[model samples]
Every structure is written in C-alpha cells, then in structure tokens.
Target: MTENEPALDSLTALDSKAPPRRAAVIINPAKSGGPALQGAIFRLCETQGWAEPLWLETTVEDPGTGQARQALEAGVDVVIAAGGDGTVRCVAEVLAGTGTPMGLVPLGTGNLLARNLGVDITDPVSACYDAFNGSDQAIDVVKARLNHSDKEQVFLVMAGLGYDAAIMADTVDVLKDRMGWLAYVEAGIRKLPGKPVKAQISVDGGEPVRRRIRSVMIGNCGRIMGGVEIFPDARIDDGVLDLLVLAPRGRLGWLGVVAGIFGRNKNETESVEYFQGKSAEITLEHEQEFQLDGDHLGTGTHLAVTVEPDSLKIRMSI
Candidate 1:
C-alpha cells in the first residue's frame, strides 16, 4: 500500500464500528409541553451523536405497555418513559426482566418513580440528557394480582388497598391540576371515616394473621407524594417488599398513625405497623378500593403482591 493511501486495516476497523444507539421515547401527548419536550429530545439526540429517537405517543386506550413492547421489538438501546407515574409503571411492566434499560423524563404532577430514583423533576432537558447518557441500576419491581385474577400487573412505587385507594379514587382532577399532591388531602379527609375491613394477611406464605385494617400499602420504595417516607426502611433494590398496615381505632387513632409515620419511633404504635417480606397475600372482608402506583384500579377483595428482585434496569445520572 502507498504511504499516502488510507490503511486497509484502518478502513476495515472504521467500517466494523458499531452503529449509533437509538432510544424509543414513549410519551403522553396529553401532558403540557409534550411537543416541546419531544423537540428537545430530538435535538439532544442529534447533538449527542445518537440515532434519532423513535417517538411513541400514548393514547387513552393504551398508556405505555404496548409502546414499550414495540420499542423492545425494534431493538432500541433504551426505552424512555416521558410521562408521569402511570406511564412509568406501564413501561416498566413491559421492560422488567427484559434486559433493556428504561429511562425517565418526568412530565407529570407526581413523578413517583423518578423522585425515588433521584431524577430531577423540574428540568426535562437534563432528564432527557440523562436518559440518552446515563448509568444503569437494577431495581426491584413488584407484581400484584387482584381478586385471584390470572393477569398480574406490575408496580414500581406502591400498591394500595382500602382507605389509601379510596383517597386515590376520590381525588379530584381539577384540584390535582391546581394543587398537585395536596389534592389528595381533600380525598384523605373524606375517606377517613370509612369502616375498617377485616384482612387476612399472609407474608411469604406463612399462616395468615387477621386484623382490622383501614389500608394496606405495599411499597417497593420509601417515599410517596409530598416527600412522605411511609416505609422509612424501604429500598427499591433491596429484593424485599415493605408492607404498611394502617388500623386506626377512633377519631384520635389517626393522630397516632400520623405520629408513627413521622415520629422517630415508627414501630411503637399499633395504628401503623410495618412488615418486610418477599411476598404478601391480603384478603379483605369486602371489596375495597384498590390502587397501584397512585392510579386507582377500582375495588377488589384480594391482592397478592410479590417482589421481583433487580428485575428492572433504570438509567439515570445518580
């Protein structure tokens, strides 16, 4: 080969280099500034020398589960959920155990999973940047089956039964738009007077323990809306599910539950009890309100939850 000519070996090496990675952004077009966010992501991907992202818009009929499966089929490097908690949960349900990492760009009122992952909620551009270039961390995703149903739904944050779910059901959308997480306060107050349902809770297939409970919150992570650490010891990647049972006796019983949640001595009160296990089965006396990741799923009499350890790979800077 001539000295001035390009080396054949170097040319082959250049041609053999891998193609640019691409991302599928499953976004909720209903969110404010959705088009603007998509534009921002398009520009950022171009600047970062990556392939153009495949934009998927979520519809009323299908949130993200279908879109996520589509992304996986396309062999995208990353699947980014660019909406709220519901969208994140739907994408996560599909991506869990699939080996493809999921990214987050919080564009909703309560970015529960993003908040738990320490992703910045205020800045969408920074979030998109991290979605394009970030490290992956394996986290646990909990699967819940209601009313002995054959189908099991996955939740990344928390699943609620009874009063908590009632709060989710009663929360007003207009108030939520104006007040954000505080909108739940109105619902909570309205739900406080409900009767406790007798629950038979079995953890890890152990013998069932009966109790009068107002709510059963199974958490995969620690915090919730308004930065409340309901399960203080909970960890997303811990490979365990944290369960909180609320059983208030009287009008004054809620005070103790509040104290137990916020006070240093959390385990001191019976009104609020915490349990850790790999799986839990709860059978309520009646059909009570049920919710998954803050989205109410109507009423159910039974809920079985199991923790899938390190099943989801979440990509973020932190």
Candidate 2:
C-alpha cells in the first residue's frame, strides 16, 4: 500500500520512530471562503510534506458527524474540524474516546472552542499550521441526553437554557452573516424584555433548586463571545462543570449581570449565581429554547447533562 493510505491513522510513528502524519479535514462548504480555504489546506499539505488530507465537505443536514466517522474508520491520524462550533462539536463527538486527537481550523463565526484554545482565528493558514503541528491535550466533554426524545449530544463549550438560548434561537441568519458575533448582542437586547424562564435544577445528586432565571448556562469551558467570562472557574480539563445562573429581574439588573460578567466579576451579584457539578438535571416549568455550545436545539422542558472529564483528546499549538 502507498504511504498516504488512509490506514495510516494508527499511531505507527509512536510504536517505532516518527512516521508520516495523515490528517483529515471535515469542512462545512457553506461557510465563507470555503473554496479558498480548501486550496490553502491542500497547498500547505504539499509544501509541508504531510499526507494528502482526507477532505470531507459537510452539508447543512450532515454537518460533520458522518464525514468525521468516515475519517475515523479510515484511521486518519488527526481529524480537523474546519467550520464553526456546530461543526467542531459534531466532529469532536465522533472523535471522543478514540484517542485520536482532533484539530481545529476555525472558519465560521463564534469559534468558541478555537478561541478557548487560543488558536489563531484570523489567519486560516496559521491556524492550519497550528492544528497540524500542535501538541495533544485531553479535555472534558458534556454528554447531554434529552428527556423527551432520548437524543444524546456532546457539547464542548457551554450548554444554556432561557435567555442565552433564546438569543441563539432568535439570531437572524442574514444579520449574523453580515454582522458576525455582534448579531448576538442585538438578539440579546431584543430578548431581555421577555419574561424570565422558571426551572428546577439539581446538581450532582443534590436537592432541586428552583428559580426564575434569565439564563442558566452550564459550561465545560468559560470563554464566550465579546470576551465575556461566563463562568470564571470553569476549565476544560478541571474534571468538573461550572454553572452560571442569571436571574436578572429587569434592565438594571440585566445591566448589572452584564457588567459582572464583562468585568470578570460574574459571581459578585445576587442576580447571578454560580455552581460546579459533575452532572445536572434541569426541568423547566414551560418548554424553553436550549443550546449546546451555540446551536439552538428545539424547545424542551427536561435536560439531563453529565460531564466526562479527560474524555477527549484535542490538538493545541505546540
């Protein structure tokens, strides 16, 4: 077989001396600059003497799960997610537990995971280089199992309900494409006027704590857009999950909460509450929009979430 064969995904280099590195790129074609990015990736592979990466373009329906699985089955040395958080999350879900390091090539808006890793988001070429020649790190992942459908998902950054999820759900696609992350601010402003959501949440087998909240975000990592610190204590490898509860009552309270998070004092106000846990069971008084990472899932009243620490291996800058 040729040296570039897909079967080279096994860690043969570790067993012996260093071997050729084979990578796979799972891309979402609808993202901006898709064609240019693909060309750049191929050229880099040729110039760097790396194996020709397995290229998989994702459709809106498939995202990256199917393509990522295919790459894994073919034994790709590393899987690169080349889109936004949704695409990254999909690829990470498939790569988890395989011990195959997943790489990040940020190509979409709100590159939350990439931002948390300090991956170069502005320069695709530099980002690709980092992904290809990076060190491996083990991070935690959240396993969210829906109560109504038994549907399971993996969230890499944060899973949120109420106001945060409403913002994601209400974000206009065209506006988001035009204004990028700023569109979320616009949506958040519009959503702030709405009534708060009521939910009962129990953490790590504790008693249910019911509250009327503006937003309840459970984070695997604390970084969010606009440089806000959603949960200051949350770390990707900490073996624990951090929760942010914003119970702001009105515009002034909302301003206070925003100031708290934006100023690095997210837990300093009564309107904002924080908790850490290994698992969370949340039941909403009424069906409300929810999001994992940033993708808004349909309205649901029940959410069961568990964190598995050191479960996924990811690539970071060397």
Candidate 3:
C-alpha cells in the first residue's frame, strides 16, 4: 500500500456484498497537477476497494460543464472537480440541484472554493481521501446573468465587475504561471487608476441605488487570497448574496476602501458600501469587464445575480 493511503480492508471486507462505489473526476488537464492528482485518486479508490474513477479532462472550448453532465449520465457516486475555481464553477453549474454531491481537489492557482471548503490544497492524497470519504455539506450557488442573457452561469465563491474584473482580464498569463495569485496584485496596482463607471443597483427589486463605482463584488463565502475576509459575515449557506460596492473618492480613496474592508466596521465607510439580499440587478452605463470565480468572461453592461441556498452538496470534512 502506498504511504498515506489508508488501510480500508476491514470496511471493504464488511461491505463486500454491496455494490462497489465509484467516482467521476472532471479535471482540467491544463493544470500542472493533473496527472499526479489522477494517480492519487486512483490509488485511494483501489485502497478503498472502490471501482476505478471515470476521468474526464476539460478543454479550452468546454471547461467542465459538459464533462460534469457526462459524469451524471454515468451515475457515479460523486463528481470531483479536480482543478481551480473555474473548473469548480463549471462542475457546480451542472451539479447544482441534481442531488449529486461534488468533490474538490484544488489543482488551480486560485482554489478559492477549496480554500473556503477547507480542503487539503497542498496534498493530493489527502484531498483524494476526502473526495471518497468526506461528508456532504450543502452550500449556496450564485447564478449570474450577463447582459440579461437567458443562459445563466453559476459561481461558487465570488464574482466581480469593473476594476476587479479588469485585473482578472489584464493579468499576464506568464506572470500568473510563475507568481500564482500574486500576479493579481500586480494587475490590481496597474488597474487602480481607472475611472469609476456609473451603476444603478437594485437589491431584491427595491429602489435603485445609483452611484459611480470602481468595482462591485458579490460573494457567497467570505475568504479570498492570502486569507483575506472580503465579506466578513458571509456564509456559504446563508441564502443571501453579500454585495460590496467600491467607490474610492479621491487619489487616496483606495486606502479607505482597504480600511473599510479590513477595519472593524466595513459598513461604516463611504468608499465601500455593503448590501445583503436574495438578489441584485446591476446596470452599468457602459459595458465593462466581468468575471466569474476569477475567470474573465468578456464585458457586460448589466448583470443579474441571485443566490440559491443549499443548492450545491460539497463533500468535505466540516
């Protein structure tokens, strides 16, 4: 037996009469850890006397939704998203409300969903064990409609528009490959000087709140890069979406925005405004960069986002 691959002989022996359980791994092959993660998951399944997993590699044209659908069609026990937040989002887009629990291996640069789920980001063996042995915890999924498109996409962690999305769109791919999440810092610094766009935001179909905003971030869970808590009180199963509208006032207004985010009271600053509701509709004066779970999805003049609580069953130790 390989090191760290638990000895599950007793359990397997006891369940010998039962049908073998299997998993479907929807992975992004572009991720560097793809082969290693697959090997680890395979070893764990063998150790646990489970059937070999059905491996599906994501492509540039189809990230993960098609593969996840294929996994569902195969009737696997769980669908594992073995890549970054984008892959997680794609798998989630297909698994939500289907009652098929999803697992995570966190192989991408920004493993935001895995981080929030407290998965073992640094160890493939441990993450693979969790995928096969962990408990189910239902979480919220945010559905976003860009430019009022009938086709909706789901994000598990967070989504952003304007400056934050600009950073995602502008980050150097080579730098990101070498520097990881820190590449965002460099891109953010360069995009900090852009003009704020006029936005009309309506929360839960209430009165529209009009303002010029540098960026607007919507969150389902709190933590982000470097363990920063962007939405302090946000919960994955809260059934509500947390919105942060950033409008830095002057040359040094970003400092206030940082303070408001990290300070004791995030709601008490003019540079940052916080809102919570079931849904939000944001209309911008013009098309701006938009992103879902750190993957830039071109530009949009309008976005309608709503929270679907306890819609996604994520298998992870709580």
Candidate 4:
C-alpha cells in the first residue's frame, strides 16, 4: 500500500470499542474495476467484525437513487456510495437531512467531494477505514430546481449553465477516460469559439442583472479538479452558495480568465463576477444545457436554486 493509504488493520482497535453493526454499500458495478473493488469492501468490513453489508447494485435505469433511498429507510447505521461523483450525488440527495451519516468509497473519475474532504481516493480500504472511525462533519447542500415543461428536479454540488454545460454534454467518454481531467480542457477549447451567451440572473430576490456570459457556475465548494479554486472563498458550511459568472468580452479576456484560474485568482478577476447569497434564479435567452456534479441535466431556459445550510452529514477524515 502507498504511504497515504490508511492502515485498516491497525484501526481494528477502534472496532473493539464499538463495533460497526450495520452498513449498506451502494456499489456501481459499471465503474472502473468495480467488481475487483468488492473484495476490498468484504475484507474491510470483515476486519471490523461488521456483518456482511447489504449490497445494492446500481442499474443504469435507476442510477442508485432508489436503492439509496431504500437503504436509508432500512435503517442502516451508515450508507456508503461506492462509485463516482454521479453516484455520490444520487445517494447524497437521499441522505440529505435524514441524519444518516454518508461515507464515500471513491471509485469515480473526478471524485471532487471526496477530494474536498481529504479522503484517500486511491485506496478503497483506506476510505472504508475512515468511514468507520472518522468524525462527522456537517456540509452545505444546494437544491437546484429546474422548471422544465412538465416537471422539476434538484441538483447538488456545482451546477453549470451555458458554455461549460454544453462542453460537458459534448465531451466524449473515451477521451475523458484516456485523459482524465485534461479532457475538460480539450472540451473547453473546442467550445470557446461559441462562448458568451446572454442570460439574466437574480440573487435572492435581487433585481435581474443582464449580461453576456460564457458560463455560470454555482459552487457549493471552492475547489474543482487539479486543485483549481473556482470560488476562492466558498465554504461547505457557510450557509451561502457561491456564484462564479464568467463574462469574457473577447479572446484576450478569455485568456485572462484562464490565467486567473491558473493563478487561483477567480475572486479577483475582472472578467469574472462573484456573488454569495441564500438563493438564486436564472433565465437564459434560449434553452441552454446544464450539468450538475459533472452529469448533464438536459436543456432548460429557467432554473431556481436554494441553499440548505448544514443539510448533509458526511463522515470526514479531517
């Protein structure tokens, strides 16, 4: 094991004090090497003297939300999401406000939330070890309600509308798998020519502010991939959501925005506008695509989002 890998066997001492009686693991079989990862889960749980966990396999049709809700209702002491960001988000939605502490077994590409929590994503055993012994931290969650023609839905983490969402929808899975987070750069470059769409935004009943924007990112946490500070001051328990609006006027302005990101100056950039509020409402001039936690959420012209402070209980190593 690597130096950063948590010593699961060493943590057995804690198990003697208070054994973990129950755990529900929601595993996504389609994630990379998900089948092999199962053995690690068994070893860790067995070491802790916990019963064989109730295993729920995620199906493409259901995406694990239903399974997670079922597990939560079944009264498991802990619910562990064993997949990528998408899987984590689905489970988090169900566990939100339920007082059930959620854990992560980072088996996803761009495990942003896990990274933010300082969880050991490279080692499944380490993640599981931390889950049982780690303390709980209250994190903020954003409820994004998209008013579609017939119904509405909710999102967690950063939500993107306009150029960034378009890039997410258009990015190829093969390239993403091969290049990892660099695929976003490739996709962003391809979409730069079509950037800067018009939109009107309102923050917590404020007057509608109109602008031509390349992308709008609603952030619950400050860091994105590559340790990029998308919103430098964003806090997971701040009780307020952060908004990063990129409205680059020209190619040079876009270049400046890129430089700002590299320099971690998102909060101080001229082309970027930042806001923190309890809620926000957005309306695009046309039907624009949006993404939540890296998954496309289809195209829509209107979106309403609100923040719930300390809404989710997460097990964190820190």
Q: Give the top-scoring candidate (TM-score).
A: 1
lDDT tens per residue, model 3, 209-299: 9999999999999998888999988999989899999999876888889889999877788899999999999999988999999999999
Q: Which pairs of residues collide in model 3?
A: none
What TM-score should be assigned to candidate 4?
Answer: 0.89
Measured over all alpha carbons after superposition, the RMSD of each candidate to the real structure, in angstroms, is 1.8, 5.7, 6.9, 8.8
lDDT of 2: 0.87
lDDT (CA) per prediction:
0.92, 0.87, 0.91, 0.82
Write down the TM-score for model 2.
0.91
True-vs-predicted CA distance for residue 196, candidate 3, Å:
1.1
Error (Å) of candidate 3 at residue 167 is: 0.7
- Tell me how far the alpha carbon of residue 164 in candidate 3 is from the true structure, in angstroms, after superposition: 0.8
lDDT of 4 by residue, 1-318 (tens): 899987988777667676457788898888886767777777778888877787899998988789989997778888999888898998888888899988899887788888877789889878988887788899988888785344434455688888879888888889878988888888878888864667899999999899888788899887877787787787888988889788887888887677666565555676778888999998888788889988898988888888888988887587
**Backbone atom clashes (below 3 Å) for every candidate:** 0, 1, 0, 0
Q: What is the Å distance of residue 24 in model 3 from its true position?
A: 0.4
Clashing pairs in 4: none
Task: Give the per-residue lDDT of model 2 (tens digit) for 115-177.
Answer: 887888998888888778889999998999766566779999999988889999999999889
Screening candidate 2 with a backbone cut-off below 3 angstroms (N, C-alpha, C), the clashing residue pairs are 9-75
The regions of model 1 sitting more than 4 angstroms off are 1-8
